[model samples]
Target: MSYAPSTAAGKQTAQQLADISRTLYERGWMPGTSGNISLRLPDDPGRALITASGRDKGELTAGDVVEVDALTGLASPPGQDRPSAETAIHAAVYRVTGARAVIHVHSPYATVVAHRATATDAVTSVRVERFELLKGLGLNDPTSTDLPVFPNWPEVDRIADDVAGHLAACREGPPGLLLGDHGITTWGDSLGQAKNRLECLEALCRLLVLSQSELHVSRA
Candidate 1:
């Protein structure tokens, strides 16, 4: 697929993306360059400025940003370069929610929860209950919710389709979706909002992991 360069607004969003990517990477949430971020142009919702593949997100620049077809997640104008492989999932989030920015992170805690959710037939979702960070996700303060989880598919589009289906059924939760053995996808109406949601969700996941570990220890 091909990609076009970003517009002026997208350039600013691109810079913010680079900044957040580095922060997340430093936190070990995006190790191995395993995360991706994108934002809808301020003037166009159908086109998105996405990170280019294989770039060290720690040092991303405006030049590393490219525009992609928001509906299909393919690079715009047809070219040799490609966006992140998970770009399709970002497209799905925008299509289903009308979001202007999206982020996917391969966070250790979230990845662990995702894998454990799908590693068995017992549960397919994780619960976020009575956590202070729950408020950060726009949920009721101290309320409980489910984080929808799905098993990973070799084909990214197939996973996107599944996420779209789940989203069509339920609009609540953490405002994000987790892929088994993969990571989390979150979005917002703006790049900063999207970044904040990703950060909050990752923190929530970390809390869950720690609490669960303590539970296991107590049980033992």
Candidate 2:
């Protein structure tokens, strides 16, 4: 489908997202077409531009983005490219946290930690404490916090709804979350901040996994 031409600001946002997507993809965090990134248009807070569905993250171009309603996640111009299936989740984060950018990635450590943390289906959050990297999240209490983890419901909208509910209740919570057996989502006032927080959280997950492995070996 032909998309409406983007304004200069929109073009910049798209390029920024494309650049970040390729960087993450090259790091193996967004293998295949598994991740999506978005930015709320500064001039129109009610609208957002998100990565289009099924495009290889490593090769995204400025034209690969779709402008969508921030709340409904519908294409804004009515016939633009289809937004990612997870667009609603990005919208929810923007609405709840007033974030300027949101990133979702399937990095190995974060995904593995999310999977293990949710081994008990009823688990709701993953607790991390005394991790200096927590400062990167810009949380009210970075020394320790429970990062909310939602079930990776098969229906993307259901996950979005749950995210909205949790974020609404925890207004001062971490700027990121985990999806059971899925991956991590992070947001920030800017794309650079969001990417930095994502790296911090993923590193924390890596440390958690390594510590667990050390404990297991000692026990064995």
Candidate 3:
């Protein structure tokens, strides 16, 4: 799919997004075409810069970013390679949280926890608490927040609505979200903060997995 040319500033922002995408991809957070990243234009609050559809996260280019109407989720210079299929979900997150940037990736830890939680047939959300990494989320303590995980929906719009509702209902939780057997979505006031929060969540998940290991040994 082809994407329309972005404005000078948009191109710059797109480069930044592309850079972050590559970094995250190298870190194994967003592999293949399994993740999306977006940010609101610095000057215009209603326009968002999002990754074009199906582009490899590891080799993202400025052209891989498309400008879309924040509220309507429509591409600016309309064409193929339309914004990520999950653009609506990112838009919903921005509108609901007043955040300027959002990152959604399918990492192993988040996917496993989300899937594990789903298998229990209990609640749809996953909680990570009492870890020192909690401070990475800018929290005073672990009890202050939980990651909200929602079941993936075939209809993207419905998933977006559910995310919006969850954000509304839980004002204290971290900005990270998980789609069961899908991936994790996180955002913040800026691109840096958004990426930071993503790293924090990923690190927390890794620690959680490690903490569960009880290696038995006998003194030699």
Candidate 4:
């Protein structure tokens, strides 16, 4: 839960997160300070650097990150800036998947699909099959897979609990999960790989939305 005072704040890793944050913000996926990103320390996977809460993603600097204990999601070596409220979700992903980086964003299409697919108290899922972008998700069977969508609970730690349970049960799951009425969270071996997976999943969601629109028009 807590770590000893770390002398270094992982400035290099924070800078990398800041760079990715700016890029995602420019793409309109991380508008305002609506999303968070985290990267595990290369030498110490138990601890990670997450973007500081309430900071504009577009304007983040290397100092804009808080190092946290991955297992407990607490700011270790506590700093003035707090970690994002959704740090629990990132921690769950790392704990369950052994991913080195995690990215959460409010990209519109993914958000739309998540809302559309969510119709029950229990978590719902949308499946994409035979899409070329499926390769980007690193699934063993690229032709088909289901993306789980969880309700946007007011308490974020509850959502993280669901994520950890789902991922642990489905070892070969897709690279990402969607939070209904919220956004998408993705993870991978590296930040760049995670970013690429986000792009691929967002595009797939866009295509799914467009196809549904076409179906409605045809029925009309």
Candidate 5:
């Protein structure tokens, strides 16, 4: 895929992505080099600016940005470096949902939720309920929303397939999903909106873990 050059704006998008990476890292949602971010070029549907692999997301810079073909998930501009190994997952979400940005992070809350949900056989059945935070999720109404959790696979394409299937079946609201023992992936119509949703999801997951811990303490 190719997009008309928006050279000036592309630089700004790179900076924005770098800023988000550092923010997520500081919050412990993306410790080490465990997350990636990508933003769609405002003027081009076929190209995206994504974080290059192996950089410390906490210290990302504009130089760490790489352009990619949004459709084929390939690096653009020929000799530019490859994107994060998870780039395919980002591309899949964009292809499936028409979203303009995506955030993936190995957050503690998200990782804990994934493990807890898997152990209890609730990976597919667990529902986030009766929380005001649900509103932030952009569901049509403030009601219980079931967030699907898929088994983790090393191959990004397999995980992407499972995510695509879940979204197809759910068929409502903003795009977000959890990979069991991995992390969360969320997207939105714009970069800011996507970042908001990612933060909200992380917060909600943390709250759930805290509440459960308190309940266990009380029971004991």
Candidate 6:
């Protein structure tokens, strides 16, 4: 699972991916092998360097990186171990959105909020307004942004399709979505940006939950 060598672009190298995973794990966004991250190879846009499946993200190392084709969903360099089971969802996202990196996490806030929305078919879209942190999302004008939430499905193909459809309908900046009762999926132009977006999303979800609870207590 160790990378052969560092590449020129500095994006596809194994160490970079490992570092990003460890950072996310420390932030508590990924716990108990509950997340995956991938960055597109800078030289070969058609390939991605991703974290291997079921590894403890907190202890991720260079040996945990694997290369896979972005188009065919096949691991490259032949004989390498399989990427994460959710690789299909990642590949589908890259194909539809042209994002350079994807981060999926089962953070507590996102999981709770998603679970609350599980009873319905319509996406639970969250709109964050009047919060200075909203600026972190990089929306076109920063007025307000609707973050779409999709229903969770066991099949990757179905989940990918719903995600793709939501992104297409929204047609806005750096689209990210949540899977009901599952987790959050976010992307950006690079690994850093993607990580930043995930952080913002998780924080916003926490704030939303807290605000609602406070309102309920005040009313009672």
Question: lDDT winner among the candidates?
Answer: 4
Worst 10-residue stretch by lDDT in candidate 3? 211-220
lDDT of 4 at 132: 92
Model 1 lDDT at residue 98: 82
Give per-residue CA lDDT, model 5, range 1-220, as digits (tens): 2222348788788888989999989988888888899998877879999888888988888878789988667888876666889888888887778889999899888778876664322235346777788898788866766666777776778877766666666677345777778888899988789888887777778888888753111000
Residue 47 Cα positional deviation in candidate 1, in Å, after optimal superposition: 0.6
The candidates, ranked best first by TM-score, are 2, 4, 3, 5, 1, 6
Clash totals for all models, in order? 4, 0, 0, 0, 0, 0
Model 4: how far residue 117 lies from native, Å: 1.3
Better of 4 and 6 by lDDT: 4
RMSD of 4: 4.4
Over 4 Å off, model 1 = 1-6, 119-123, 140-142, 213-220
Q: Residue 27's C-alpha lDDT in candidate 1?
A: 80
Instruction: Indicate whether candidate 3 or candidate 4 has the larger lDDT.
Output: 4
Summed over model 3, clashes come to 0
Evaluated at residue 74, the lDDT of candidate 2 is 82
lDDT of 6 by residue, 17-129 (tens): 88988887887878878888888888887988888888899998877877898755678887776688888778878887888899898888877777765534555665556
Output the worst ten-in-a-row residue range by lDDT, candidate 1: 211-220
- Top candidate on TM-score is 2
lDDT of 3 by residue, 1-220 (tens): 4444446767678788999999999989888987999988887878888998888999998778888887667776655566899999998898778889999998888777666555222226555666677887866566545676676778899888888887887777787887878888999888899999988888877776677753221111
* Candidate 2 local lDDT, 1-220, one digit each (tens): 6344557787777788889999999999999999999998877878888999999999988888899988778888876778999999998888888888899999999898777766333337777888799888787888987877787888899889888988898887888888989999999988999999999999988988888753111000
Deviation in Å, model 1, residue 191 alpha carbon: 1.8
What candidate 6 gets wrong by more than 4 Å, as runs, is 1-12, 120-122, 213-220
Q: Is candidate 1 or candidate 5 better by TM-score?
A: 5
**How does each model score on TM-score?**
0.87, 0.93, 0.88, 0.92, 0.88, 0.87
What's the C-alpha lDDT at position 64 in model 1? Answer: 74
